[model samples]
Target: MEKCNCRSILCTQMTSSGPHILPAVSSNSDSNLQKRYRCSLVEVIDVGVRYPPEWRKTLIMLLYAVLSTLLSSLVVVLVNNWVPAQEIVSPLPDLFPRSFGSSAWAFQLSEFCSFLLLTLWLIQWFLLRYKSIVGRRFFFILGTLHLYRTLTTYVTVLPVPSQYIICENKVSGGWEVILKQTFKLMSNGGFFLRRSPTFCGDYMYSGQAATLILTYMFIKTYSPDIFWVYQLFCWLLSVTGVVSIMFTHTHYTLDVIAAYFVTTRIFWWYHTLTNNQDIVVWKGICHGQETGNDAHG
Candidate 1:
């Protein structure tokens, strides 16, 4: 009687906790329904959380972005301050254009598109209206693209005419100074400034193309609801940017071509790494439908 009374009390408490302790159902459909309902409750409690599957991995991504920025900036500084500095405009043989147009409008347009996307993302983050935790993970991977490009820039020294014209906004001090200078130049409406000694040797890989393409992928992968609209827009932007590199005479044809190839490959590699059972939609260029997950959701 004593044992029976204790067992009855335990059963009562478990029942009171409700159907969250889901009972076995007759069919697979019923089981799935219960699982989804449980997940919804969990999501409600975990909304706005930016944690990823691996905090350490995410941290490495963030660090890659920061370190890459610093290293790229360092490259700029060293180019400016190094002994026997090679700043004379050794223009890369462009099969396309001998000289830049009157204004670097096309290159600037690409920069504008990249900046616009970044601005939108920042606004979403500040408003506490971000789409998914995965998006943040992607952002870090996106950042590493810059790192790759920066390393490429130094590895192959292909001097171009635009580097000749783009003034050396020294980044040796810090990235902040370079950013300020960049913003100032943009505000003044100079995409490719007059040739300067400090702004040469970063011509092998086009950072501009990398930035625009990566941003495009980010927008497409994360915003599935408007996938077609964003994809078309981003595709147009990317093509325009690459074409502009020639017209603006900013980078060699090879540089832009290599940028596209490298960025696309890295993008593919990243998606391969991130596609998991927990992922809702693999909505980028390379995609797959994982079972037990709603792709449209």
Candidate 2:
């Protein structure tokens, strides 16, 4: 009878332990199943995720900046060697013509002060607002100003007035003389004609062209003098342009159009050809969706 009772107690203990052991095993199996399936599902969805458009724009912007800097440098180097040190005459006609009314130094000082103040104010205002569209407009305006300055230089040198002739000969001496002779020789309207080139025309054109080409190549190639001067001019013009666009309420409308089509196209082409696609892809993934992919590609 005692043996039978002991067997019943043993059976009861075994039954209780069986329930606990089965639950623990099932719980472990469920956890393992979840760990295995979770990552696989995540990988499938993540692989299909597309890059955002803004990231692409940012990539393009970065490429533009790098290319432009390199080209500007190249231009400075060429300009330092090729461009003559002589000061060229200003192109603007004197609306308030007066002899000895105001000293050149005083006039220059006044102009400088005025421009400095205006630029400072404009920059302050821009920073206060900090809008991307505003920035774009500024860059566009800056490019236009550069274009104007370049064209004006050409115009001023091209039409040599009779009064401006310092010597008995039609050609003024110096580099200008060489340029005039060449132009005269070329003006005969033939594949190759006999004409003297003037410094004002030929030299100016050649220098400008060389600088433009160099700047287009890489900004780093240029000397510090050329790079800084050109960069300053560009920056001021950009600020002015942005202010005008914002005040006139023309934000991205014209600014983006001009930047993409006219200003940044050269840089864009350079980056498109040179950038690495695989690196760009990996970078884009690491930097999040907002980071651009175009720069790497």
Candidate 3:
């Protein structure tokens, strides 16, 4: 009986100890799993994080503007030097009358103006951070004036028939006939203000009328004596057209339209590299306004 009691006691002790060992092993496994989970979470957070700065983006835009201007100036200079002046044909005389001053002067003046405008644009791009609203407005005006002058050359050279009295015919029908009549009346001082309108508005309405008038007055080679009395008037009108383009806000409609895409691309590249959130919204608004105007126009 004593032996049997001893054996039973040993078996009971072994069974109880075995149950305790299993619980300890389970607890250790749970602790290790928690440590691994915490480590994995930390790694995931670190992988998803991102950091960037705003000043770098602004520098990039400034650099782009500078490089582009330099390259364009170099190309223009090379072309001017390499090509003979006689080889260049002024598109104005062939389309209108052959009476305008030497085509060479027009070509040289155009190149000079292009260089001046590009220099101004570079200055504006670099000084963008310091420019006030008024400064920006002034540059905008200058850019518009420059663009108008450039486009005027192209428009004058366009193959379309002139709207001046020289090109008029006896249609006697269609709205074109009425338009020609109205233009003639306006040119001869029949419109408002008692005298002929010498504004760009009038000149543009007559469609290349300014070119015709200038060619008639200043072209020494083919001009008749009748054009001499109005020489002063023609000069005044030409100067007025150029100055009006500089000061008037009305002509900037097209400039703003073009500037939208250019400025937005610049701002976007700047903001992207700099990570600036403040000016991004404002730039977006301005860009939107330009786009809206372009679409409407």
lDDT of 1 by residue, 56-153 (tens): 66567667666666566556444443322236545545667754443457656656665665565455444443434454565576567657766776
Looking at candidate 1, the ten consecutive residues that score lowest on lDDT are: 4-13
Q: lDDT of model 1 at residue 13? A: 18
Tell me, by lDDT, which candidate is best.
Answer: 1
Q: List ranges where model 2 is wrong by over 4 Å.
A: 1-95, 155-297
- Which window of ten consecutive residues has the lowest lDDT sum in model 2? 4-13
Please rank every candidate by TM-score, starting with the best. Answer: 1, 2, 3
lDDT per residue as tens, model 3, 1-297: 112122112211124345221111222355544332211111223465443434455455445533433332222222222322222431222311333212223323333333333343345345544334323332333233323433442343222212221222323556565455545544442211222112222121221222222222222212345756444444454444333322322222233334334433443464354457767788999999999999999
> Top model by TM-score, which number?
1
Report the Cα lDDT for residue 69, model 2.
33
lDDT of each: 0.56, 0.33, 0.33
Give candidates' CA RMSD values in order.
11.9, 19.7, 25.3
Measured against the true structure, the TM-scores of the candidates, in listed sequence, are 0.57, 0.25, 0.22
What digit string (tens of lDDT, one per residue) describes model 2 on residues 102-165?
2223322323433443454355435533334333333333334334334433333332211222
- Model 1 bad stretches (over 4 Å): 1-60, 80-89, 98-103, 121-132, 162-198, 225-227, 276-297
- lDDT-better candidate, 1 vs 3: 1
How does model 3 score by TM-score? Answer: 0.22
